[model samples]
Target: MVTTRQGVRLLGPGDVDAFLDLARRDPVANVFAMYRARTTRLEPRWLGGEAWGRFHDGELVAACHVGANLVPIESREEDARAFGERALARGRSVSTIVGPTEAVREFWRTVSDSWGRPRDLRWNQPHLVIDGPPTAAPDPGVRRTMRAELDELYPACVAMYTEEVGVSPEVGGRNDLYRTRVAQLVSRGWSFARFDAGRLVFKAEVACATDDAAQIQGVWVPPDRRGEGLAVAGMAAVVELVRAEIAPRVSLYVNEWNEPARRAYARVGFQETTTFSTIMF
Candidate 1:
């Protein structure tokens, strides 16, 4: 039997170990890397401040992440229901329980049936892992350089996030939460940029990384720079730097509908491992 509660707390690292012991895992290479990262160092980022979790007989079994709806759970109907209730109580407003294929379907069928949100069971995401070597060579004219200071990096980072998500990075207009978030990421070493013709033209961030694998995210290029292989050059440079510093197994995520991005990742030598789904609400 599974018991769920609102604002539930667990001794993160220990409970995460319990949850990982509860079931079979995501087959995607990137998923495992991210999960391992979270279990070790990324826990504070996802579980800080009044988050949620599920337990069976006082043992942690599953959990729902607070800010980002990246629910990492072992499959169990009772556990799924309990976690869903806690998420709803926390105003998670989502219709997903992503696991392996069958588990994903069951989560959607049971948890969201009467919740009023239309469930999209087929929601899929493709993840790629960098293992041995890069598939495509860097563009000949492409150049890469890292910005040393947050002030030097903020403009490019902000522009890339805005362009990709179609929303501007939060700056002090009224409440400074959004602006502060961008600043926090840079302070934590999460930003990167590339330039051409003296113009800072491309940007991406290391969403999560360890000494071995760095997940590349928010890769964006202005429209005028598209098709010129700037992405190949810029991204290759990022991978090279990270690999030199840590591990060579780089990874990234892309939406299934994002064909252009899929192509770009392929050019960067990423082969998909598995699909994942997420709900914004």
Candidate 2:
């Protein structure tokens, strides 16, 4: 462990236990890091990124995973500053920085000049979490997307991606890569869907799964299915299933401007836990 006079330490695969202990201090807020730490074992070479830690008097206070997704786990201004300086020193290698709103914004303030302006800044993201059974009745038909349903499910995944991110996953000729991810979700039983008369009606994926929580993503109700009470029931079903089978709690973050989503989640009993921000580079 190389510790700097400033207390910033670059963590490697060997530091998994310490990284995890730091992440567990607030499980829900640190779900992403906890998930990656457990699943990836802090491996030096993991999905094209690395993890770094900030220590204070030999105690790990914060950590950042920099890669395709630059995520910070409950970092303070000082911790964010150190991580930001490290990122700036590396040039613009990260694709995004996402975490608690304050930490992300503070970190961005430090690296914006070196990183250039972001293509998109989702600043008002409400992080919501739900525990126990849902209040609304779950959609009985909701179930995991089967391997055979990949062909039918792929388009819905694409639609959700394009709608949520303002650009198709197919952009930059990455359609094949996008399809593979959807397939992987289905194959791992991480995807859920409801079909009416053999047509896909609603879909969601457990994007991050930790022992304490499962964060849902790519939730979608087709354009024609809007205002039909599908989202509430469908989401209820997802929450019930995920809570019972995957994790003890379910969580997700939605853009604050998405009123309909906020309403739908509230109907399913999800309460705001925190605010997360994302800087898409």
Candidate 3:
């Protein structure tokens, strides 16, 4: 187990419950990290990362997931600095620094010299969540995507990814991986969409989920459907369905510049609880 002189220790299977409990402390904010922990608990090989924790008098105070993505949860400056040193020592394995805005920013400050400037720094993402039902009227059409509709939903999924991430899901030659992901979500009833007259109009996915919360991602509406209230209504349906069948709470992070989406989420009863930042390499 990797350990620092200051008592930041790498956690393993034996610490699964504590790791997940730390994540559950802020269920909405830690949904992604909690998802990772739960998955690791069930199948350790699936985590493909190292989890580290900082303790104060034997109580876990902070946690971090370092691998393809570096995510710090409820971390202090000391935790960030220690994680930064460990991550840097392992070389540039992390492709992104993503989590609570302040923690990620502080971690970046410590690792910048070794990690280099990022390709993009998204410093302002509002993390919003809704526990109860949405205020907006739900669209009956927004339901789980079926395997038969995979062919039709692929393009919309690609469009959303390209627009949001600035790169197409098909960037690395074939889109086999992306295709598999969409198909899996559909099969698991995690992909939700509105198909009007057989055309995919709105789409969203429960990207990650644990017992307490679920993180929604890839929310989208076709260009022609923009400003038509499709996103607001469709998402209300998505939220309702997710809450009923998946988790009690649903959360998503939106770019601060996306006013339309911000308003849409607001209409659905989502309120910002925290800010998140992403440093993409």
Candidate 4:
């Protein structure tokens, strides 16, 4: 790890333990970073980008994951600024900047001028977590998606992505990559959904997981199925299964303005633990 002028250095295999220690400070909030580090072992060849560490007084205090997504782990304002500067030097390569609200905000402040306008800036996202059984009744009908169901599930995944992100996953010729990701999740038994007469009614996926926690993403109830309480019960089932087989804790973040989704998560027993921010390109 050669130190840079700003005390930020590219992390490698040698820094895995220290990086894990730093990220585990808040496992739910740091699950994405921890998952990446564990799977890639801090190797750039595997990471497809890099993990960066900020050292102070010869100790690793904070770190950032830079790849398709830029995520800061337990970074303070100054530390995030330094990471932002390092990213600026490397040019804008990530599709999104996301993390704890303050750190992401500070990181953006440092790079925004050079990075120019973002497609969207979500300044307030509630980071929620649940460590025990959900209060709502689990929907027994909801189960892990089978690999054979890929052709059936793919369209719903695309719909959810387009509705949530305001763009089709097929845009920019990424259909195959997105489809493969969905298939990978199914193969890992991380994708969950409920179907009625072979038609999908609700869906969600475990975006990442570590021993400590798992993060949920791409939650959706078809527009016609919304308000039918599918999400609440489906999430309850998801939480139950994830804790039983994947991790002890489950987490997810939602846009602050999305009140209905927030209410559904609350009904499923999720509690707000922190705030996150996302700047999407």
lDDT (CA) per prediction: 0.56, 0.89, 0.88, 0.95
Q: Which ten residues in a row have the lowest lDDT in candidate 4?
A: 1-10
Tell me the tens digit of each residue's lDDT in model 4 across 110-160. Answer: 998999899999999999999999999999999999988898899999999
**Stretches > 4 Å off in candidate 1:** 1-46, 50-61, 68-70, 74-79, 93-122, 139-153, 171-180, 183-189
Compare the candidates by TM-score and give the number of the best one. 4
Every model's TM-score: 0.70, 0.97, 0.95, 0.99
Per-residue accuracy of model 2 over 53-159 as CA lDDT, tens digit each: 99887778899988788998869988898888888777778777899999999899999887887889999899999987898999999999898898889999999
lDDT string for model 1 (223-255, tens) is 787887777767776666656654667777666
Which scores higher on lDDT, 1 or 2?
2
Residue 84 in candidate 4 has what lDDT? 88
Sorted on TM-score, highest at the top, how do the candidates line up?
Answer: 4, 2, 3, 1
- Please say which candidate is ahead in TM-score: 1 or 4: 4
The segments of candidate 2 whose C-alpha lies over 4 angstroms from its true place after superposition are none
Q: Write the per-residue lDDT of candidate 3 for residues 114-169, one digit (tens) a residue.
A: 88878889999999999999999999989899999988999999999999988787
Q: Arrange candidates by lDDT, highest first: which order?
A: 4, 2, 3, 1
Q: Least accurate stretch of 10 residues (summed lDDT) in model 3?
A: 40-49
